[model samples]
Target chain A: MKKLINNPSDVVNEQLLGLAAAHPELHLSLAPRYVCRKDIPQGKVAVVSGGGSGHDPLHCGYVGFGMLDGACPGEIFTSPTPDQMYECAKHVDRGAGVLFIVKNYTGDVLNFETSAELCKMDGIQVQCILIDDDVAVKGGGHTSGRRGVGLTVLAEKIVGAAAQAGYSLGACADLCRRINQNGRSMGVALSSCIIPEAGETTFLLDNDEIELGIGIHGEQGVERRCMASVDILVELMVEHIFSDPEYVRVAREMNSASGEWEDVQLVSTPFSRGESFIVLVNGMGGTPPGELYGVYRKFAELCDEKGVSIKRNLVGTYISSLEMQGCSITMLRADDEMVRLWDARAVTPGLCFPSCDDVTSCGTSNAD
Target chain B: MLTKKNVLIWFEKSADAMAEHKQELHLLDAAIGDGDHGINMNRGFGKLALELPVMGAMTLQEIFKHAGMVLLSTVGGASGPLYGTLFLKGAATVGTSEALDASAVLTFFDAGVEGLVARGRTEENDKTMYDVWAPVLREYELCLEAEMEFVEILAACVCAAEVGMKATIPMLARKGRASYLGERSIGHQDPGATSSYYLINALYESIRE
Candidate 1:
């Protein structure tokens, strides 16, 4: 309610306008709201992902040289409609094809599925890779299964790099699926975020309480308990992620041959000892960078004690939940290929890796 | 006793009802879900209202199809596709018809409910809009069998919808965002079910007017 905005209804439009103004490399469209990279490679497979607006630097920030080719942002905490995705894909798709990186919420899933159907009807080859890497929920209970969290940022980068390397649409989708299966994330929120239109926080917590395993939409977490120190919180989240059971669920994938959705069974492999990991300690908007490093420091110590090697690490506010004060930890079991892909240079408004050309002069700009 | 003009008027009344109860629906949704059902429904219906002028010139099936497209494109949540599919499938049942009677109305509701079930994959007692829609369809069938007047049958259906909507208050949600709350989801009226009751009540009001 106390945020800086002209009007509640114009929040998304005005914010998108600001994004376009700040980032010259991105193009914004109004009739159907979507952000696309201005200089998309001529024939490479296009990667597109999007969700609600509060999770900024997510679907849109990842749109650049080596990330998503386009993103379709919906209203606050609402999934984007099929028209946005369909039109964005049409605009971005070259001769090769377009890949949709969808999160695993019911509205998102249904809307993207409809978009894929629409694209296919127009003779564009579309493949969808769903990310559901949050290990908070045990299974696909009443609501859709595990919600996509921090792992989405990593998926966009890795899959975007693969697409940049001229991988086929199928190959990019396959790699995205593998990344989704190999990663796990858990989060805890100190407080709830206020949706702009609602003009109130979604939920309330006491000063000494924290909600554990929260989705990004400001939904109530799975469990609430007395607040703990940063070290203890990180340890708790790490333990949950490491000890979570192998998750198996039914997912829908588009069959390009038949142009229909086919049910595909997906399994998330459990974390094991002696595996190398790409650890991401992400802030949920309100948390400071120094605190995130504190989280990373404790998380790294716990991983070392558990015999898991940290192959690579990123600590920042890459994915957010409005201005909610919280952080999430994502761990991807990294193989040689994943490591290489993760290391690939990328330049986007949200994430920028120092290129070989700039490293000599810039001396490593702080990406966070 | 139902004409294409009546169907159009029903849609207009439904939109007005959604606008009137938008805040009430949001309050109900706030208790368990993301709390935007009212806003989403109002936006969808508002868009449909804009197209009403064009829709008035079309066949009944065409009007329903156009309304479904508008809802699908404008509404941004689960209700978008659920309600969109309802209208689309209902449109298929009355292709190019200028008017319909009690049996046709029954077929329309049956197809719409079937489409909702297919899209949402929800069973009975999931505490969704389906709770109201399924019962209203059943009551409509019963009223028809008893040879009631058209307006009387619609009134009976609206009453069943109201009863079904209130019945969701004590039921645990097994689908959509409300399901995330587990046991806490009980004791709150299902927002989607409430809007569905408004829609049915609007239909009754339209015919009586």
Candidate 2:
């Protein structure tokens, strides 16, 4: 109930104002909450992505070089109304077509579609890419589909970089598809979050409780158990994600399919293997880096045990819940060309590729 | 048969019931939900009150249309869409006539249930609004099949709704936020289904009076 803020109701708007002030290089529409790069190229496709406001350093933080062209911010944990998204699309449109990057939530998908209609009315070429990377919720039903979480941030980064590098609009979109196909995320929550406006925790769990396979919005996880060791938690998550036959099958297929991959250890400027990938150990909210890194350590150990090579490893609070204590792990298999592109230099507040000297290869081999 | 006065009466009754249990509902939801069911429902129907007076001699559809708009705009959660769609679809079936006879009322209820299903993707055991609505809809059809008097039919549907609502207490949630609780959701009555029962009870009291 008690926190630092001018008003609970004005949180989103105030945060948006602060974000714009802090990141002067990013362009934000006064209304409709679109955050894009300051300068959008003419005749180049613009990528528009959005959702509710709680998950920071996402949707908006990624609105810089090599990421989203624009983002629409809605109320906390609530999908932006169709009106907001529609206006954002209209505002972010350059001569080139615009693609809507939407999460898989029903309301989000529907509202984005509504905005797409408005885009179409203006004769704007619009396509939609839905990110459904969470493995928590059972999928293939009329609903209860997987949620879009960490992978969304990855998609914006990779695809945004591709688009900026002069890939055709379709090619940029194809990169997005490849990212989604190769990526999967799963999370667990240690505690609940207090929504500022509501002045109460969204959900309550006992001191010994932990929720496995949780979503970013403080939604309950698929399973709850007594708090376990960090190693145990990572084991469960890694087992659930890696145990999927499809994930391995897909990785093997992508490994062979992405023929033009560069070997990082072999050469400084390797050609495209198109097989580089990323693993993000995302923090839900209240989790501290020390704790997050503790989990990441376990993740690295597991990947080593499994022989699943990581193209690049990113661990931090990239996507989050509303100050909830938890973390999600996402794995994205990249082709060698993709690995090259991932290595491509880009600058954003949240995402940064350190100098080559700063980076170190963790796994023993590409197979491992 | 519900005259305009009766429709207004239903809104008043539901509002009263919601006010009485608002805190309890909030508490129940706080356990495994976002903890705003009471406030959200209250805000939604509270707006329904102001519009009803000005909507003089409005038909069931018109009254429901107004309610739907209020719910959609004020509730601001999963309930917003579920309840809003219910009223919106209900309004689609009944026009702006000044009164609703028993059969017309049943038709509206049927439409509302359909809308709830379509919007929420909830099924019989999902521990949601559908829990209250499913049995009531079935009883309503049963009453019509038996050719019961309109009064009897209304009473039967309301009773069935109340039972269904109470039955949610022991049910494990399988939809929406509650489903995340898994087995932990077993003992708590679904907050959404509880409110839905209040709605049906309100309607029964108004029409009967």
Candidate 3:
């Protein structure tokens, strides 16, 4: 409850205004509340992703060169309405098409699906890819399957790069699905974060306990256990990600031919013994970078021990859940193409590459 | 008698009831959900309350459609689309009818539940509003088969909804945010189901008044 804000209801609005002011490359639309890249290239597939507001530097931070073309933020921990997404997509589409990258929560999935439908009705080609990389819950649960966490940032980066490279809408969507399938994430929370509107934490944990397999939102994790050392925690999380069975589930894909949703079964290939990985040691907001590096230190050692080569690694707060004190580890099986895409230069408010001089010359950026 | 005016009254009463129970719903949601069910529901209905004056001149189908559109635009969550779909699909069933008979009411409920099922992909035991709505539809059909009057059938449906809402207390959540709690989701009444019960009860009360 003790946070710096004027009012609980205006938190998202005020934060969005600040984000818009800070990031001049992004254009903010107030009526529908979406942020889009100001200088979008012509004839390139547009990449859009969004969800609740608490997971900052995610959909919005990824909205620049070689990443998201637009993002629609909703209320805290609530999915954005379809109208906002529809309007955002309409404005961002540059005559090629728009691809929606959605996390696999029920509200997000439902809202994104509705938005895609609306866009299609308005004569815009739309494709949606659902990200469900969290290893906490089994597939086909009473609720939606796994929640999309850190891997969402990875997907946005890779797919955004693909779109920037002039990949077709179908190609971008396929790459997104591949990234989603190859990634697995596991998280543990030392404490819960308070939601601004609720004025309380979603859950409580004792000083001696931690919740395992926690989602990005302040929701309870799959299990609770006595607190362990950082190395032990990293070992446990790495093992869970490595040992998870091949994920199989049914997802909705847009049937461009008939303009309806078609049921498509997707399978996530399990990690092999000698596969290479793009690893991310992500903080859940409250954790410091020093501690995150502590997680990566043990994580890298464990990967080396398991014969899994770390092709690339990002250790920081790429995605977060309010100010919850926790960290999640994401491992995406990376090939040469994925590694190359991961290294692509990007500039946004949340992520920036100072070495990249001109955004227009990079990739398929055409000055329009 | 279920006239167009009665339908408008039903919506007004439903909005009022949701506003009254807003805090209670938020408390229930705090236990297992993100704690915005009451806030979102009240916001949706509050918009409907504002539109009621303008909606008074529309046909039953138009009124329901307007209500659905308002909820879809104003309520920014899972319930927005789910409840909005319910009203939109229900409006489709009413077609050009000026008022509703028992059979027409049954048709509306059937379509509303179907829309909810299609949107949410929830089954009977998913611990959602479907649990309440499915029973209400079934009980209304039975009441209609017994040649009950429109108000009596509505009363019966409201009673069924109450029972269904209470039944959600011991059920494990299989859908929505509460499902993340797994077994811990049990013992708390579902906020969506509770709001649905109030909506149906408000319908009956509007007719009685």
Q: Could you estimate the TM-score for every candidate?
A: 0.93, 0.73, 0.94
Cα deviation at A329, candidate 2, in Å, is 2.3
Candidate with more favorable, higher DockQ: 1 or 2: 1
Full candidate order by DockQ, most accurate first? 3, 1, 2
Of the candidates numbered 2 and 3, which has the greater TM-score value?
3
lDDT of 2: 0.73
Where is model 2 more than 4 Å wrong at Cα?
Answer: A23-52, A64-66, A69-132, A135-147, A159-178, A188-193, A197-240, A245-276, A286-305, A324-326, A336-368, B1-16, B50-66, B94-101, B144-152
lDDT of 1 by residue, B56-159 (tens): 88888888888888888898888888888888889889976788899998998899889788777788899999999988988999899999999999999888
TM-score of model 1 (CA atoms): 0.93
On DockQ, the candidate that comes out on top is: 3
Per-residue lDDT tens digits of candidate 2, residues A83-149? 5666666766776777778876655664565556556667766776667777776532323456789
Across all models, the iRMS values in order are 1.4, 3.7, 1.2
1 against 3, candidate with superior DockQ: 3
lDDT (Cα, tens digit) per residue for candidate 1, span A1-368 = 79999889999999999999998779999879999998888889999998988998898888998889999999988999888999999999987899999988878887887788779979999998899988887646555678889999989998999898899998998899899889999999998898888788878899999999988987666689999999899988998999998888877888867877787888888888899999899999999999999999999999989999999888999999999999999999988998898888788888876353555323466434
**DockQ, cand. 2:** 0.12
Better of 1 and 2 by lDDT: 1
State the lDDT at A98 in candidate 1.
96
**Model 1 residue B125 lDDT score:** 95
